[model samples]
Target: MQQSIMSTLPLLLLLLFSSLFPAPSHAWGIHGHLIVCQIAQGRLSDAAAAAVRGLLPSYAGGNLSSLCSWADGVKLRYPWSAPLHYIDTPDHLCSYTYDRDCKDEDSFRGRCVAGAINNYTSQLLTYDATSPSTQYNLTQALLFLAHFVGDIHQPLHVGFTSDKGGNTIDVHWYTRKTVLHHVWDDNIIKTAENDYYGEGVAEFVDALMQNITGEWSQRVPGWEECSKNQTTCPDTYASESIAAACDWAYKDVTEDSLLEDAYFGSRLPVVNLRLAQGGVRLAATLNRIFS
Candidate 1:
């Protein structure tokens, strides 16, 4: 009886843990979003900066990073939004087309991150200089933009549809068991926190914001195009993420593989690039909206 009871404990514990953390966590973890916001906040135009400060709720105290995780915070309560953080593509094709692939699991449709970004950006545009600070859904728009931009940059968030965006394919980060989606969402950012900065997340974000002093420090308002063509700007980001997901995030990963030195060595650079781009684009978007 004692042995049998002990044998059931691990399963019981696992069930309890699952209940506590029922959903796939936020993309890029807390640190990734914070770093993105802090970097963007540092680059804001003075008018854009002041406007952002005016729009935030009193609790956030004009600090954008403070509300970086708002979407994840409200996810459980608003189940309809669960699918808004990512888009899924069929296995190995590595492309995104809105006409076919933009719908989520819900038949209601158009709930994917790409769609949400476009919708929310339009919503933000509805607010103008004469609009009262709290006159519209400005806070929601800013919060959604801050979070979704980071989501679109995370490769696995736009990953394969067949394997449930790498949620089903299991792997290990060194010795611990984890799934591919999570490894990108949280592990890489957490590892970066512990290894590179060796400090608290806020401190790390501050350090990152301080270092954005190159050519793009004073980022302009409407320059999010990573491609030459002016159109397709939104889908272009989704497509880029899909390519990264197929080529890199899932590279060398398998059900039996242990992700370690070779995996981190090559892939961490991509993570940093996405983070930087997310930050720059987010800042530029806000500047366009407010300035």
Candidate 2:
């Protein structure tokens, strides 16, 4: 009995130590939570929805200025972000079929399985217009739908075989240990926590959207980029070590040097471009579902 107790003591102490140190923040939680709140507010009206969407670019430090503005700005008559024409049939879900090694861009069969999930949710929202469903309005359902679509656009969010969507790549941000996904989702955001998310993240996202909206402008080309870049995109991003990805993703902006650069200076324009697409798409989804 004494010997057994002695062995268990060390295990108990180790467990206690771990419990004392909470895991660092998860980026998905913060952003996803914010997305959910936006969708819920959108239920009011188009003006309400726009007002809600406005709040997103400015969310910060527990402030509600953006939220108040969004509530005021939503308009029922405003144009929806251009629909991804590729979503024509509404049955195709996977946008990155090419990411999985499918050679044909037109093949409906090769889309990433997650894209199917996206399509399904999108269809669900579309149909909700005529008839309503209780299960659909649940916070998780909204958050999952909103957040997953966002994830699909994040090049690294759909990781590779070796890294398993960056879950396997381990690295340290400051003194704490973290995986690649967590680093991208949380560490990067937390690193820039001081910048008012509404002002900073919103400004960054807005600029990205404006720049790409002028260039790509339409959802079809945006989807086409996903199709064309799928196979190479994941590997292209995974090509860097975990640390490099973090550094490249944030670079001069997240740090204190006050240096101004596109949020994605060292990386391919595709990442920021897609991020803008995802944000606008997310906003559009909210608009359509609530309109």
lDDT of 2 by residue, 1-291 (tens): 574355445434433453454333322334422432333332235643443333222223222222221211111121121111111111112123334432123444434325433444554453343343444422223334454444445444443434444556566555667665565555444444334345354454445545644766665344323335221122221222222333453333222222223332334344444455555545544544545
Q: What lDDT score is found at residue 184 in candidate 1?
A: 87
lDDT of 1 by residue, 1-291 (tens): 574355445434543554566555847777788888887888789988887776666545788987776777667666777788988887888898876678887645677988888777777766665555344467667787888988889998888888878888888998889888888887877777787877577666655555455544555234354456332255777888998988898877888689987888788877876787788788877777665
Q: What shift in Å separates residue 281 of candidate 2 from its native position after superposition?
A: 2.1
Which candidate leads the pack in lDDT? 1
Global lDDT scores for all candidate models: 0.75, 0.38
* Over 4 Å off, model 2: 1-116, 119-123, 126-131, 134-140, 174-176, 190-265, 268-271, 285-291
- lDDT assessment of candidate 2: 0.38
Worst 10 residues of 2 by lDDT: 81-90
TM-score of each: 0.83, 0.44
